[model samples]
Target: MSEFIDGVITEVPQQYSPAGELDHRVHADDHSNDWWRHAVVYEIYPRSFADSNGDGAGDLRGVRSRLAYLAHLGVDAIWFNPFFTSPLLDGGYDVIDYRDIDPVFGDMAEVEALIADCHSYGLKVIIDVVPNHSSWEHRWFKEALTTEPGSPAWARYHCVLGKGVNHELPPNNWRSVFGGNAWSPVKNADGTDSGYWYLHIFDSSQPDLNWDHPDVHKEFEDTLRFWFDRGVDGFRIDVSHGLVKAAGYPDYPQHADRAKRSAGGEIIDFEPLPHWDQDGVHEIYRAWRRVANEYEPMRAFVGEVWVDTAQRRAKYLQHDELHLAFNFGHVGAKWDALDLRERINEALLHDKAVGAPTTWVLENHDVPRVVTRFAGVELPKSSGDGDENESADDALRRLAVLTPEQRVVGTRRARAANIYMLSLPGSAYLYNGQELGLFEVVDLPPQFRQDPVWFRTEGKVVGRDGCRVPMPWRNEAPAYGFGPDGSTQSWLPQPSAWGALSVQEQQGRADSMLELIRTAVHARKSHEAFGETDFIWRDDIAEAIAPGRSDVLVSEHGGAGNRALVVLVIGTDPVDRPDSELLVASQPLTDAQIPGETCAWFSLS
Candidate 1:
């Protein structure tokens, strides 16, 4: 059993003030003792995990059954995607109720059981909470639509009436993520129009709640308490920065006059209207923090801050906001050593600036799998050279010819990327199936496509469903062990060629991608570099390891006082030249190596 610390290292300072610095050290005594700083969170999409019953959908029981597997995987916490009562619009982002679990997944009792089971395995549970908006079918919205404009329910949402004289439209000009308008017209039950429209910011079925209302604030506070009381460890808040919008609802600079032409033309901007930022949103967060503090000391609250700049991202973590905010700059970055080093340096510096913990993720439900995104390798195409080239009938044979040596080299590069993410001084989130080296399955048929992004963009955007397919458990099992026992189909079909990457098959192979993940995770837990926050980049050495040199070297200076840990990752991919070891090898990785390959580890003595 792991020893429990009263408080884990939670905060990393931007600047060192030897004597008068803020007590950024996270100890058991601090109110916000965020344990997530050192956690390795594994994300699970309920629909794709294992299904307990034969209902063709995954459920809480399915998750409960997999506790042993997760616990054995060495993850500190599990971040479950939304399983709350929802219309399934936007994949459960449109919540109809905040307190109950969706019957399709299971009931509240089953969720409670899952929580209990996870705790039994020493695994903390962090569930997704969509605080920005709720389904149009939510009771509050139903009441707002039926009640008079002056009623309490009416004030709970952002509703504005159009003025004929002024030509007033939706409060502002912010665009919805899924495209189109951020406001939907509301009609009263009496057959007369309410004249006022509600703000959505996403799908029209999801109406954004007004934080300016005391009742709305109370509802969320209560909702959080409801889950906290049920023993939930924490929350991964969805669109956390979007809670409170500007009060007056002002117009933004027009990117274009029409929807098709504007940069963010589809939706309306509602945040800069009035005093949105200062309008009690922080107060609500502080209140939630107070309640969270009353429970387990290390309880965490992570927010999704989708801002572009590090400065703006730091604002969300300033004080009493979120314990950790998701950093996306790295995920969106192109695969370049210099670019990665700069991004990492920037993120670490930002964490110190905010005095709040930071979280890193390479892949998530909304993004493509990291293997497909970060692996700098391309499969050789069929050249029709009758002698060496093979046909579609020889696809599996072609796959066989693609040597394990090649797979190892490619996987090591990916593993090095994982090392870079985990070695940084913050919490790291591992999306489901990422550890298995899963690639994005773009072969999804049009009929089975569920992502709204695909429909809104007319397929211009590939959408995120390809990454949300069922997890493969066994090599030969139907639906890759995601469906009912012996069933061939699943809620979403498993990727056709995923059998070779199944967990069962990889578990037996010492050199499989799954083994690499296990090794990296295990090493992360065992290394102080993964847990400690003092990292000073060795600029001279870092620049020397940049591309065209065949290796990437990164050194971090810090340890008690004078000691330092230097990590060297050697690339063996085709892009990297052979015999290109510029610096004397400090520690050579025993794993496979190919041209342009990469391996990671630190030397600390």
Candidate 2:
């Protein structure tokens, strides 16, 4: 067993080896040019990941200290959420300076060291790039606030005159993704309200930049080079579809679906918003792609594009655009066999059309933990009528506290989901704490909540604080060993139950979620079946034995020497295991049957 000193692993246990007794890395030394193609990129919400200095917030040094743990976990890359200079209004998405590191995260030298350390461990680093908007405190926005309406400084953002006769109303009938109006009135230097209202599709503190401006293009291009020159592998472009708006600042349809964006960053009701998924946005990505190609072993770009359909989403993945775009279909799909199959096929088929690899994401910083979402736990309805009248605190109070039985079901399904996702042909993204089987911190005190969504909606929306809770590292240490010794608090409170789910608790256990993920990731990296292969739906599994059984899903990928079979049983009934050599199973199996809510892989060569 690995020994832990204040949640930091003091000794590297044998089981923690990236590869076991046998070296299974098929392409061990091949850090090929296109590493992101099938790479397992682990997403880290820096503030919640680790606290090296016991300052209560996670920082770059914290992440650097945990690099070994990640390497042991067997991910090819680490994708960080924004650590840029920000006001923290939108969880670091409201970037104040694209070129500098936020003090809350660390200094530039630390980031440079982190990048160097990651490369030393054969781990590539992907940082976030928030181009859609700038923080209200950003120098550009402050300048815009001080300048005249049509001045060059103001031209950087969408600051336009309001439509009311007295210039008192917002420019158009648009709603913020967080809540209320999308346009916030600019203030004069002496604090008088300026007639012009600036657009912020999400939070009022995040003013949208005018992408039409040539300076805006030049600025972002320069920022891309700023990081690319620093050995950064790639960037996860935030709100990739919202940079460009329709011409003339067209008014949003009055009766169109105005559903609030989900915690997962998906449009709950995905219609073409006047300011989202516009055709002009592709031009920006195409330009960005050229900048990325400027570096040797060309850097990659993965867009957080949330469009209505798979076809539209694929547009962002064209040849010279983004290398990959997040496929939210997996996160949004119901926990049913047919639903998952459809989502998987849709992503594969559409991404294949564009000759781009499909990216699979189960959970991220913005979404509810899959363990909570898949547990079949439902929050009670509010007494108030709909969201408009709902009290955010009351709704948070009413969030479903998972029952013990629900935890079991959710964990089993989540494990199976990871195995299933990893078996696919393209790249997969793992959120931190997911391997620990951490559930959403639904009961976070209303007073401690900091997400702008909750405050913007006046507590009518609980926001994503639940999923951003600090990671539990030790079962017995203070703050669950999330911070340095003697540290008593984390940025967000962690549940006591997490003591049983911490890394120290599951370090060497054979059946632990952490180990399962490690084993799966190692298998994915070593096995040739996951590399280059023809993906086929294995109807033969059902046709040969469980004929007419729709609950069982089977697929195969890889060529002659590296073929592998995947079997997922989503229904209650057990299915006959594949005749090939058993490689790995999400859960312990009984006899020769794969039980419900279980996924298994087998070597077919």
Candidate 3:
């Protein structure tokens, strides 16, 4: 591993031997100061990971119980969705308490224990911080309601007097990401007009915080110190590019607003959006980076900054700002060789210029699962006005729904895609259940859906709840083994067909999705070429579409450019394999050739 004087090189701690856990990764003798540069982090939505007390919700203790499983899976860190105290609106994004864990998830003690357990398993812990907004129930917001307009508590949030007779109209025509108007009128406890409104870019229950307030800045610093002292390895900042809105919160030109913006022909790069990715946001991060650097091991921060272009995304990764900002280009690109190649190259080139590691991600909790997105349908846009104001809705709705045949194709492509993602330079994030080859559950009975987008949009949009379902543990009668032995209640419903996809069903089978992931992570962690932050496009191995050989996607990097090419190939063709030792393959090749729908790593040693 590359070393830097400023970086922390950690020795592998004596590990924990939990029930049914496998210790498979090779422990490195040395590591770089930037351990996160090439790390593979797994995202966990706590409420869906496991339910320890049969409370029908996944809790911190449940995560502790499964720590060994994650460790065995060979991930470097676990990035959890917010488990802070909340009112359950926006699925915990509407955080009421930043200092303590939500009672439903467990308390502060459980969080401390979970972190210790993860470290014991040689895994780091990164928790989510929803800094852009706060639950309306937060003490600050509640007090803001009681105080007069322009009061200190009111100034902490985006609270302002409405415009019109008796102050009835919203401050501006800004739109709510959840749906409808972004401003919600505040009423006094006696149910009378308070002559003011609060800006809630998301659900009305989540009022946006005023980063302009000096107190807000100090408050987050305090929050960061509290958790860092508690030993969290790092934090994944929610809406990292969104804490500061443009001055005045002006209206976005409605005429220019389009329902879908995607990685199609023209990117969503040059639009004059006023609410997100503002310059002031960087100042906040520059200060945050300073706070993160204070501790040993140099605490890390990954941004969920969904800007329109790679260059814009890179701006957040400037040395003193954020360590990593997600590049969504590859994740949102169509499942085409050219589209994928260009996105990856563009991200690598931009990040290289910025002297930052490029982050490659296939899917996350906020968007449609890649399997469904890459089914060659209209790329399902995550609900909101972010990507060109929404997501890509260019494809006809008829093709959006995956048919039985489409699912098979999608699944195979997804398998190959994951290997391709693991092969890329720099860091990567794997959402929970991604290894299980999970797709968005579109057919959830309308009644079972809980995403606020469904209600806020009056069912016009389904939002991302489908991707957040509690994962299947085993093939049991109720909840597919999500809860306790005899329980039927999980926060979300599990599909009956998921029985075959359960961890118990796929555990050790060579062709199983679980095995493919385990082997891929194991191989990725061990390979020298895969760990470095470099990618040299294989100019000779052109991507084609002629049937069998056309499906191949190859990119090689690491070591001398010409001396020994580290080739990563994914396709279905029976061919003369790369002239190298096969380090690992997502699935066994056919007839000694790189098979279709499989990805293989080769070292030309």
Candidate 4:
């Protein structure tokens, strides 16, 4: 499988290996050394990003309209959430059709335009691909329901018989990541009980597919070709660890957590289970890799893999498998400096062993915003595990727990943290509203809330709606310019305070969050030390910050031998730093010292 890109023959070497990877004949060097290896990809939740039409929801046309903004922000790539035909359940993860664009969004032609526009700006376009499961409304799922259990349609997904004498119970006791039974009773098209259960790891509307079927492999291979032909630069695979379940669909380990979660459920790390991170999943990637290799600049796959250890996380990025896997260890860490350093060290060591650069993520669409996360009292990992499943209303009824003082601290810390994050080697991802220093909108009206996690738990859990609120593009309008004009109302309500955080407001201010980000990102893209693999720790700074607050940390990049590309973070409190050429600072330096909540890049003398 190969194609020519700019006179260069780009194709995965056809070779054989038992591990489902390219053979020794095909070296990693043979693969397209794509721009993604050094890219700082910006993740856009399409519905919340800039809206072009007055329809109040973002579409491909809106994304195209905003290419100049992303280009100016200096990101090498833009990764969009799924825009495929979907029921909008699970935030569009329940894809109804892989090939068609949703009506709410534009058509395939609009997508082609968006890609062309992005390429014009020298930005690569990567769209979401939800491969682990498809919507119950999907054509295959509908046919699988009525075509009999052993039919071709049924074989495409994990459609199977239920248990008990009358087949009344679910197929197994497996739990859904969204809570309740993982197996949902199948209803015939004629509106009668089918007495069989189908597997859905998340929402019941999203039924898991049977990857063991050869047809499933061929179908996705064709899909890869479909998008590759369409000029899509890459795909962010929804659940890369998922695809092939362990044989027999066994129950989780006896000691696994019963409290269900969408993140691949409770990971029983010590033992392998029915699904999630199975070795067979790699074989699928190898085949997909061949398909991607056939393209011009070589399409990439970024996996949303949620594994426990860094060692296990590294396995997915093997030579022939996925190019990058999100390190959740850093994503879930608290605001404490010690924990962050430890996570960074572990991530670096693990990814380095597998010859992959470690990725850093400060905030994403799924979780609480970094400013909000930092504003609150830094909780231990177990601090707020399950808050008695507080309903959306109940949670909103509570006062704004994040105090004004806390917000100021949180915002500063977030901006400074990002500067430090970008300075690190490897790639980084910036979620939609982080540039505006937008905290989570934790108080959306009950009627406006839509995350499936809320309904799945019977409103007992307020899902990730807060962070997914419509972005504030301009300072004016009740909807904060998320939509086209002042008259259009955004799908999700924009907070009144957003007028202060809007991009329109931040444009001219030198000290605005947007400006800080623009400067840092520019430095990241153009710095010679950046994107280099050289990293060293400077522990001597601990003497200045003192033992009571050993929070200050400095990391030297690029200058491995004589000179150094220095990055010192004075997080806990302000501290004097050695005088040097200050390249960029998240905050104004005081007395030739790195101030608290500031990360400064330096050009060593």
Which regions of candidate 2 deviate over 4 angstroms? 1-32, 254-271, 379-398
Error of 2 at 260 (Å): 23
Best by TM-score: 2
Candidate with top lDDT is 2
- TM-score: which is higher, 2 or 3? 2
What number of clashing residue pairs does each candidate have, in the order they appear? Answer: 19, 2, 6, 1
Sorted on TM-score, highest at the top, how do the candidates line up? 2, 4, 3, 1
* Window of ten residues with lowest summed lDDT in model 1: 4-13
How big is the RMSD of model 3? Answer: 8.3
lDDT head-to-head 1 vs 4, winner: 4
Q: Estimate each model's TM-score.
A: 0.80, 0.91, 0.87, 0.88
Report clash pairs, candidate 3: 7-33, 385-389, 571-595, 571-596, 572-595, 572-596
lDDT of 2 at 378: 62
Q: Candidate 2 on 114-196: residue-level lDDT in tens?
A: 99999999999999999899998999878776677889998889988998776888889888888789998877778877788
Question: Regarding TM-score, does 1 or 2 come out ahead?
Answer: 2
Distance (Å) between predicted and true CA of 247, model 3?
A: 1.8
